[model samples]
Target: MANLESFIRSAEHGSFSEAGRRMSLTPAAVSRNVAMLERNLGVRLFHRSTRRLTLTEAGEAFRVGIAEKLDGIQAAIAEVATGGGEPAGTLKVSLPPSLGLTYILPLLPGLLARHPGIRPEWHFESRPVDLVAEGYDAAIGGGFELSPGVVARALAPAHIIAVASPGYMAGRVRPADPAGLRSLEGVVMRAPRTGRIRRWTMRDAAGQEMPVLLPESVVVNDPVAMREAALLGLGAAMLAVPDALPALESGQLIRLVPRWYADAGAISLYYASRTLVPRKTRVFVDWVTDAFGKQKLAERFAGSLM
Candidate 1:
């Protein structure tokens, strides 16, 4: 079973180390398992290379045939072994640092109190994770190009609004329109993907899209740092609601243009996709969805500047 599982994980991740980490084994152990499987089958499953593992034709076909059935079999074994189907395992997840800290991180206490059986392994990341290839149980972020065998559940609207510290806006004329923002100092975000300044058009109730650029006063790649810069009265920043919500509520920050915002997309929880969703992952998904509802997050953090 270890040998076969190792083969499948190696095929998926194309790396012995990643598979080993996910399975709680050493890379050498995983390699040995794969070797044993190949010997037993009398065929080479992967073309070994220094950088990555590539599945051969027979390996690909074998993987396709056994993937679904193996999932079912493993799930069944786990269910029987655990007794009463209680979710008790390492729940690996990837989370965006700022947004995860602001919103999702708060729910940990309740989750731990409720399900002490479940152990969480959360990684704070800014890059898009390959869920299957990296063996993550889940990932929560925005603008993910969905990998196959994965799915998304929307948590809240990913809306960005112009915001500034009250001190920063004190001596300045508040912009009546999005175009008026150009004269103000700007704290801008650098895109991690392109390493360029990120820009977006603001949309009004009249459905007009207007391009607006703020004069740069501060620059950063992190949303948390962007929020900090705005709070420190450096300049106005186009901030996503989740990172801006607390400061806005606390009077440290105020929304700049009450009728306009950028519709970035939804902040979604990317789930672990398989034949059957694991019990731990399912409970986690439900817990977050329910908490977001209770807090009326979509309403409080709603993109509409009004």
Candidate 2:
């Protein structure tokens, strides 16, 4: 199984040396493992010339059939083994910058404790990432914005709420209706990945989704920064419930529209096309989904005032 996975990763990487580094094996060891597999199969998988390791016709066909499936099986085995033994291996994941810091980072330690052998390598970026080309095992972010050929699993849904600090609301009259969103100063977010302003969406009385327009006063890309600004009374900002939960509880922030909120949609994890998900990734995904699913963000703080 090691030989098969190593060989397949080497092919995807286009160089045994590169694949060796990713797998943490010596180049010589990688070559030997491939050779053992070739001997067992009685076929030349790679036409290994001095210049480059080229996949033979048979190798190409074999990879097409087994690569992703082999990866998934390997992941499952590792995850299942964690209960009795340490799940030792590197797992790579990609996520949005703000979500990675605020949500995933906090949950990571527990995951590592449960599987002491698993080492997590996280890539947090605002730009759209190519999971397969970048070799990420999985990713977490808003909705199902996965690239073609990827698979996604929804973990939890979050609603967007407009919030400000108590000081900001102390001198101001709160709007009694959703249309009142237009009168307040808005904090605009420039999405680091898409380079677009974070849009606020809400359901009208008729239950039709509509975009809320507010007076833009501050624009930023990072979510944490935006949250901080909102706490300091810069302006009202729309944020995911999970991101705003702590501040709301601490009395550092106050909800603007208590009953009306934007529909932020679900958060999910996306992975490259594989027949079986890697064991570590599956385990983490399961844990995260199970952990966050119990909370209903929209209903929890509907009338919260900090």
Candidate 3:
């Protein structure tokens, strides 16, 4: 029964050979074990051919049942291992670079204190990821672009704000309003969406929408670097409120204009599925949610301007 279960899971992973490697068994052994189980059950679980191996109706049904059973077993084991105390496991999470450094990294100590046995390994990326295919337990990004069957938790609304260093604006002409942005030299992100230059989209006081395409001098995609440039008097650029807060409070970076608001929408944390959520993913989510509830994070970071 154990071999049969292993074979079924391996098959579901898309390749017999790959499954064998994962289960630490030989491909021939896995094939023979599955074949014996099919013979004993008197049903075809897999339709085998040289070109492809496909699941039979019985096999599909069996897989669905086994997948659920496997998930239950994992959860039971996690519960027992933790002894209803602290969660214990290696948690794998992927996060956007700026958010990970600004938020999660700072809160690591608290999370570790709560679940001393659990260790979280985070991937700070500027690109999207496939949770199941990449073997990630969870992912945090500015937006939820994941396919259906994935679960999402809203972390916070990521507000993009336009700011510039005090030194940069000291002697130069600052944009008096949204219309004056045309004359200001701006530093924007260099990416596929940004092309040759970037535009800072803002809303006026009268609820009017505008896209301000200012003059470009510096273009870089790294958010942290952009924040540094803005602090060092590079030029006016749009940044996430959280990333800009420290500089704003320290008077390193100041709001570009009171009328223009750069809004990039919300940020969220997503996982492949709740049905098979690992203990590590659950504990991390719980910790972040608790942190969000207690902190005036946005306001504290944005300073008095926001």
Candidate 4:
């Protein structure tokens, strides 16, 4: 069972080193366990190399067959061991770097103070992750395509607003509409997966929508870089609210069209939809929702553009 767990984690991360880090073992130990598993199965599970490690055909099929069952077995054992009391175990989660740091990281200290038994294994991801396939216990972000047995609970509106440094907006006239935004240079973002400049449809409070066609003067794949470029007076940037909110509040970045914003959907907390959710996850979900409501973050995030 330990060998199989090591193999599944190694496969999920594609690196023994990372798997070892997660499992609190050395890379060599993880490698040895995987070797033992392969020997026991009488098949090569991985094609090893100095630069990369890949699962063989038999390994992939084996992982597909046993991964879910292994997880269920682990969960059942954990429930019995803890007696379903104070939830204890490492809770693996995926979160976007910039946004997660801004909004979620600060909430961690409180969560730990309340639930010392729960250990957090948080990974910063710029894109949506496959919760089950990647072995994440939870994921927080927007625009994730729902997979089987996953559910999303929206935390707040993820609004994208055009922003520019005061120096960059100094000499230019404020755009009256999205079309007028073309007069300014834009440090646009390339879609991480598509490798194309992202398009935006700006909407006003009146339910009017307009397509924004900015001349892409500079391109970046990272949201943090996009915000920095705009901060350096390079060009206008369309940034998610959580990414831009700090700067906007500090007068580092100002809204372009205060009345217009893009709706990229809501920043949501996603977890397994199973009825018998782990207590750690249940507590986390409840804590986050309760805190978000008390702080009125949804209203703050939504009313910022207005």
Candidate 5:
């Protein structure tokens, strides 16, 4: 196990010294562990040099075969050690910044209190992440294309609505229909992957969907920033209902057309597939699902309002 771990870490870091630092061992110890593993396997794993370390072809194959299995083994051991106790490990996750801060962050304290052994390492980004390739335990967001060996559990619907500050709407006539929004100044978001300004298509109370063109006055790349622009009375902006809920509740912002919203698909928690799922990930998935259920957030996230 130590030899496998040493080899994996060394390959990842590209240096035995760095791997040793990570594993809390001396560089010589890491090298010796790898050397022993190589002798037992009867193959050179890495081509070592004073300047750099490169993986041999056989090393690449071995690492690919063992990396996922090693993670499973580690998770299994942690699970057994904590049988009937709390799950423990560094839980690495990726989340969308605004949604994570507004909705998910508040739930963490409770989760952590329940599983005190768990440590969370969270990355906040809007882009979809490759969970396995990036070594992430899980990710929470929408629009993720699930590759093979990955699965998702839906948490809530990502419904988008058009909103603007009361101040911005005061002098202008309120939009009675989607066409009315055409004349309004728009604060829009640019697609991160495509770099094109996103167009808004909304569904009315009758379930009719149509695209509305707004005269763009301010353009940004982030949903959070688009909300900020709307709050500043820059223009009418399209934002996720959850992202805009706080401001809407506080009366700082108002919906342009009450019964209309855009469907951006469901927000989901994504994780890797394995027979013996990691207890840490399982607990988190259940906790989040329960939290959303208890709060009745699914209805809210679905854009249902009084």
Candidate 6:
């Protein structure tokens, strides 16, 4: 078990030293343990180099099988140890910063109050994370590629719309349709995974798709920054309705092309799969799902443009 644990941790971090820190052992000890495991298994698990470490094909197969079984075993042990007590543990979760701040963060206080035993550690970034490999308990965001042994529960559909400050749009003729947007100064977002600026395409109330070409006045990488740019009247931006809702409600921003919005996929809660999911994770999933339902976020997130 010690050898297997060491091997798994090393594989997850891709560094003996980092895995050692996690396991509270020295790097030398971790290396020796993995070495013993490799000998016992009669296969080389990793190709070790001074600059980097990579798993062999056999190692990848072993990791897949071992990781699942290990998670199950740990969950079973945790269930028995708790004796069905209140969920308690450090819950590590990841979320996109803009959505987390606008919608989810507000509910944290109440969540903690209800689950006094649970402590939350949240990482807010737009980049996708490997839940099991990085040791995240769960993540909330859109467009995450579903990895093996993980599952997602949809929180709300993500709808995006064109928006700008009323000040910016005041003198400009309101776009009567998608084609009219090409004349406006646009605040575009650069894709994080790909450096290219994102192209705009929206669906009308009648369900016809139209692509709008905006002349770029500003290009940003973060959603919150993009919203701020639009509010500053830098230019018009395509923003998720939920991210722009508060500003729109406060009259800081206005929705343009009232009948068009782009479908950006759903915001979902993702977690590892196990026969016995840890109590802490289950409670969080339930709590967030209920919060979204209670707030009617689904309808709001769908956008009012329709």
Name the candidate that leads on TM-score: 5
If scored against the real structure, what TM-score would every candidate get? 0.79, 0.74, 0.72, 0.80, 0.86, 0.80
Query: Please, what's the RMSD in Å of model 5?
Result: 3.1
lDDT of 5 by residue, 196-243 (tens): 989878887687887878887899999889999999999999889888
Model 4 TM-score, all chains together: 0.80
| Model 4 Cα shift for residue 257 (angstroms) | 1.2
Q: State candidate 3's TM-score.
A: 0.72
Error of 4 at 196 (Å): 0.9
Q: Write the per-residue lDDT of candidate 3 for residues 170-191, one digit (tens) a residue.
A: 8888777666766766777876
After best superposition, candidate 1 residue 16: deviation in angstroms? 13
For model 5, the run of ten residues with the poorest summed lDDT: 73-82
CA error at residue 33 for candidate 2, angstroms: 1.2
Per-model lDDT:
0.85, 0.73, 0.71, 0.86, 0.86, 0.86
Q: Which stretches of candidate 4 lie over 4 Å from their true place?
A: 1-68, 303-305
Q: In candidate 6, which residue ranges exceed 4 Å CA deviation?
A: 1-68, 304-306
lDDT of 2 by residue, 142-259 (tens): 6555676688776655567878888988878897655687777877798765788877776644565556786779998877778888888888888877778888888898877676
Sort by TM-score, best first: what order?
5, 4, 6, 1, 2, 3
Model 3 steric clash pairs: 245-301
Q: In model 3, state the lDDT of residue 30.
A: 77
Clashing pairs in 1: none
Overall local distance difference test of candidate 3: 0.71
